[model samples]
Target: MNCEHAKGLLPALLDTALPADETREIETHVAACEHCTRELAALRKAAHLVKELPEIEPPPFFAKKIMAEVRAASVPKLSLLKRILFPLHIKLPLEALAAVLVAVIAIQIYRTVGPESLRPSDMDPPRAPEKAQSREVAAKKVEIEVGPYQSRTPVVSEAERPQARDEQMRAAVDKAGPRRAPVSKDSDKKGFAAPPPAKKAPPAPDELSKTSLVLEKKAKQSDVETPRASAGAGAAGFEGPRYKKPEEEKASKPRELHSDEIGFTESPPPAPARTVEAERPAPRKLEAAPAEPAPPPPAGLARETGADMALDRPWLDESKKAGAEEKAEAEERPRAKSAFSAPAASAPPQVVTVRVDERPRAGEKLLELLPSVGARLTRKQVRFDRDVYFVEIASKNLVALVGKLKELGTVGKASVDTAGDETVIELRVEILGRPQ
Candidate 1:
């Protein structure tokens, strides 16, 4: 048999599974081929080693212990809802008992202090002295004669009647030019008389004109005088005290000194003034000689031909040179690849280009992430199309905020910019379908 066929039967031969003919053939091949002989010996050694190992029996109650551990491990974790509901079992009875106690106390309070306290007292009755006196007067009766008699009206002459008397008095008043009526002697004796009307004094033409002129003059004088007086007072208030030197005051008030008044033996003669001539050093020549025109700058230091005017524009000369080199290499070959080529293979785009697509909409996802990340949306704008949202968020913990935002939704686009000391995150969210 060939070496491959004999080697395949080696394991079966060790186990004594091969038939007599095949076993004899394998044995003959092993005897002649050194490789096959070594392989057979290795197989025999492996079998012997496996057989020599001692068998181990399990300890008592091994299955029970294993089953107990599995049951403990398999116990499901408690969810928020389960934990919340668990407390209701103990709380419901306690709450119900508390409510019952409150109701009982309310009912007892109502019974003790209710409508009975508001009712009027029956023990005391109201009393009035005036009412009692009126009742006493009403109780006494006065008898009246009830004889049947003819009723007669008093006869009054037309000329002697009160109507005639009133007309006569009115006519007399008109004829007398509003003179007072003469009171009867009986009325005068009774001490009752109407008072006389007061007379108004006649007005003088000259007095009215003089009074008006006097008032006008007084108003003009008051207006003119007030400003000058106020200005003088203000000037006096703002002016500072005049400061006189001590020597000048002493010269002005010179007094002859007596022997006893003089403190010194004699006044020392005034010292002559000495003018100081400081030896000022010659002024150092601080002005440097005009520097010779600097040698023309090196080529590297010289400004480039296509320098950007905007400060923010990055210097792309190195990148351009590298791209040119790559292009040259590609051109030298038969196939010249374009500088901007398609992606190498079919795979997810690089992290720099592609962003995660959050499943939840932008606004809701940001709200969910705010508390966990401890971030605030300082500024936000929602698009009219309801498909995009732009938000500016600030946070001290930038790492945590970025991490939470990634988990909140698919981050379509994210950028970090700084404003003063705070980090401002600008996010552009692409709204997807409604959340589940």
Candidate 2:
């Protein structure tokens, strides 16, 4: 074997893909040649030396530091509890409720046991503190105490009559000096100031009458408690619950002047008697006569007024004219047709035709085969020119590849041409690729 052949086979010989004959020949050449023998020996020794090279060991702390840093920088493992519950909507309300419950309880406890602070000394004794003062104040308040109204009838002995007289009342009335007008008490037939009429008397108590007399007894009960009350601001209770604010007395007032929305007061004169322009009597419009199949008016006048009768009647007139014309033409057509007769009875019909030539085409089925052969030969892009297709490939022997493609079915004949600068093949194809 030649040195070049032997050298080329050396790698394959080592890989064992070479045929036995080639391997044997290469082995014989290497054995006979001393230079090749020495080269092979050197290659073996180099490979052995590479295999024997020592493994490197980094510094002891290198791995430890790297591992520590990696661990420190690594993402933490998510808590399974959080992972399981985070995205669920159900847990949100539960967690919110729990948090709210805790907050409410905490607030309640705080309010229940919060510090007891003293209020300002100037404020009324805290919380109805002065029971005595409060009772006094309350007692002074004008309260209409309702007792269990016990109903009863009064009895009087008829003999006690003439005691009721204006003179008897005048003495009592005058005695009670120019004080407040006192409602007089009632008197019986015997009068004698009728025991200051029982709690309540029917038949209208004789108050301020000739038969009645008002008592002069003077009693100072609660100063605030008075039978007659004045509609003044002083009556509203003071020192009520902290939440009850003092009453606000807004005196109702009557507005006297008109004001604009902007708060500017303008004494505007009454809108000048609106001489409402007597609505110009909506210009009377001339009414047209109603239509009841009336004969159409002259075209000129109707057209001037754009009357539908004149415009519409023409269509009917045109239809009637067309009918008359059609009838006259129809009556004349048969006579006209009868005057013309065919000269012959039978004859072959003449025909005119032009011929066209359509070239046979290679269908998609055959075009697909071109790609397979072209791909096997490492072909890339292919271009078409009329009946010829040019294929660009990476390898030679493209002719042989084209021959293999011819085995596939085709609608037309083809020939491969491989004369080109680069590895290119030309094919006489009738079909080219189509847009998908």
Candidate 3:
């Protein structure tokens, strides 16, 4: 037999399914040919290896579990009619029957209590006597007038009421008249009539004087009151009586030219003065004394005077020199102080450092923790010694990353440093031996 023919029969020969003659032929050829022999040996070894594997008996519910999974994966082949006529659950049918029953009950109740059944005509009807009584009561009600401008007596007929209202409106309009009118003396006289003077009884001289004084006081008060009244009228935009000045009143007043009205008295003659004698005084001779010169002021007093003069006028040489020196000294003093004093130094940036000890397989631990920490492995570098591993990871949230790192391994020391707008975190992981 050829190698290919023997190879095809090999599996059947192992299972002992071939005829005796074919099996003998295949075994003989496989033994003789090197290629077929090696193939036969490899097949026998594979079969032996499979047979040697431990048999695992399935659990009691294995078949059921497999069937459930198959059902979940498979799509049910339901017909349209079958799907539409799917069996209703007990609860659904019960709920539908309940709803129908409630609807029937509601309909029965509505019919029993409907408007047709409870209408007044079907229950109780109004009698003719009630209509007549209501009519009489309405007729006896007298209409009462309402509103401020309405008359006390209500007008029953509409035709006469409008005419009366029109008359009243016309009367009110006529009474209002012109808003502004010139004040005339005739109108004033008509508005205010003077009373007739009463006959006075004979009075003593003192009583007459006292009466005159009272009359004068009253006239002054009347003048003052008149101005106040006129001012109020002016403020209200109404024209009032205008009073004349004293001169105008005097000029307007009529006076009688009689001898009794004016009289001039003559001056008395001058008297002559008597002459008196004058006493004479003796004369004395006068002598002229020489004028003495004034002493000069002391040096200190002169210096004080100069200083006062300088203070009074700072433009003077002494004051100007002193002021300029003082200003220059003040300017130089600040410069010297500033030169001696050092500038304040700014505070250093805060740095936090943390150390972790004896963490072997740190790289593996970091890789396991990367997903939990929400960090992406940017770059990874293994040292030439293969003992140290440098891992660069990036995370949007630093605090979460730090927390996750702490949970990952023993945190010997951890530090966070902030510089300007950026936060820098340094982590040093120590491996006991070599990285795996």
Over 1-436, each residue of candidate 2 has an lDDT whose tens digit, in order, gives: 7777666666554447778887788789999988777776776677678878999999889988999888766635445556666777568878899999999998776544332111111222331222212221211110101101110000000000001111122223444222111112122122222222222222222333322211111111121125313312111111111001101111111000000100110111111111100000000000011121221121112222322222223333443465544343332222221111011102111111111122123333434555665532111122221222323232344554445444433333333333332322222233333322
* lDDT, residue 344, candidate 2: 10
Instruction: Report per-prediction Cα RMSD to one decimal.
Output: 50.3, 50.5, 49.9
Q: Count the backbone clashes (under 3 Å) in each candidate.
A: 3, 4, 9
lDDT of 3 by residue, 112-183 (tens): 433321322233333222322221121111111111113111111110111221222223343312311111
Candidates 1 and 3, the one with greater lDDT: 3
lDDT of 3: 0.32
Q: Candidate 3 has which clashing residue pairs, if any?
A: 352-415, 353-414, 353-415, 354-413, 354-414, 354-415, 355-412, 355-413, 356-412
Q: Write the per-residue lDDT of candidate 1 for residues 161-276, one digit (tens) a residue.
A: 11222222223334422232222221223222211111111121123443443343334334433443332222121111100111112121111111111111122122111100
TM-score of each: 0.18, 0.19, 0.19
Per-model CA lDDT versus the true structure: 0.31, 0.28, 0.32
Model 2 TM? 0.19
- Give residue 2's error in model 1 in angstroms: 7.0
Off by over 4 Å in 3: 19-21, 56-104, 108-436
Residue-pair clash count for candidate 1: 3
